[model samples]
Target: MTNRALVIQDNHHQTFDNDAFMQARNLKAEYCNSGTDALHAIKSHRYRCILVSMDMQKENPVEIIGALRHAENTSGLSPTPIIVAGKDFKLTQSDIGRLNISAQIRSHHLK
Candidate 1:
């Protein structure tokens, strides 16, 4: 497993303070402020985990997940595990099946 992680968020403030957690675990963390930038980073780097915030301002979180899936499929890369973060995300069953979300981290649980 890579000792790296990618966090996709519209803002720099991470709900879980993931950077510090990663540091404590001796892992490297990278942050992307946009979905496009996140996709580029995913293609170029290897991450042990991908954490995406559902409360983005510019792009829809579902679309970002779709784009990431498409990129992986087109490039013949193994599926990268993804975790979603939100305080009030309510994805339908179809949406969850489509994205294959591995897990969710609530905003409150971060603390």
Candidate 2:
């Protein structure tokens, strides 16, 4: 089985960096630059994990999260863990109430 990962980023540079990192770790990384394409990828393949840039401009992050949830529910696919990245990735109480997120880690905590 291939160790595959999907990365969604609005910025090309960020996407390139993420793809390089994943490749270095021996993962088959696929890149999607827009929410629509991300959603399409989610529906079409089983990714080990998904990396989503919170700063995606083509579609709101909340909307993408909702669509992911919907895809999980409708397709009977296991929930793919999503790593939301960006300095502005703060989730409000309302946002937390809307999605089933497990935890939030500060960027500084990452090695």
Candidate 3:
């Protein structure tokens, strides 16, 4: 089975360094440079790991994450593990949400 990961980022350019790190680990990543793109992609594919950024969509990644979770809740589809990437954002809501499979990846560590 392919261990694919979906990463949602508003600025794919600003995320290059982190992408390289994931690639080095042999992770197959599907990145969307905007929330709109990510939402469209998720409707078409399944990912084991989901990485979301707070700065996405000009500062509305929360909506993207919520949308994913909502899809699972309403459709009874299996929820993928999510890794929220950001500086000011916290995982509290994601933890309590329907997506029990989740984690956090700080953006600053992209250095």
Candidate 4:
């Protein structure tokens, strides 16, 4: 597994301190402020994990996850673990299963 992570967030709407999470995990992160940037990064590199902020005003986190999953399928890449980070996300268990999300980290749960 790689020691890097892909962190996608809209700085204006970020609900959690992603840097602290990454630091605590001892993993370096490549930050993407937009879904477009995130897609490009996923195409070029494999990350140990992906942490996507669910509070983005410009992009829907579910759609972003779908796109990322699609990219992985099309490129024949292995599924990367994806953790949704936010507070009170409305996703149902079915949605999470369909998206193959690895985990959910509530904003208040993170240091």
Best by TM-score: 4
lDDT by candidate, in order shown? 0.83, 0.69, 0.69, 0.90
Error of 4 at 56 (Å): 0.7
Model 2 accuracy (lDDT, Cα): 0.69
| Model 1 clashes, total count | 0
Looking at model 2, residue 83 earns an lDDT score of: 66
lDDT of 4 by residue, 1-111 (tens): 689999998784577878889899999989998888999999999899999998887889899999999999999998999999997788899989999999999999885
The best candidate in terms of lDDT: 4
lDDT of 2 by residue, 1-111 (tens): 458888777776542246555766687878888778888998888887776767666678767777877888798987777766654568887775566554443334332
Candidate 4 weakest lDDT stretch, 10 residues: 10-19
Per-prediction tally of clashes: 0, 0, 0, 0
TM-score of 1: 0.89
- Model 2 earns a TM-score of 0.75
Instruction: Report clash pairs, candidate 1.
Output: none
Model 3 lDDT-worst window of ten: 92-101
- lDDT (Cα, tens digit) per residue for candidate 1, span 1-111: 788888888877655666655677677878888889988998898888888888787889899999998999999988788888877788888988888888887887655
Q: Which sections of candidate 1 miss by over 4 Å?
A: 20-26
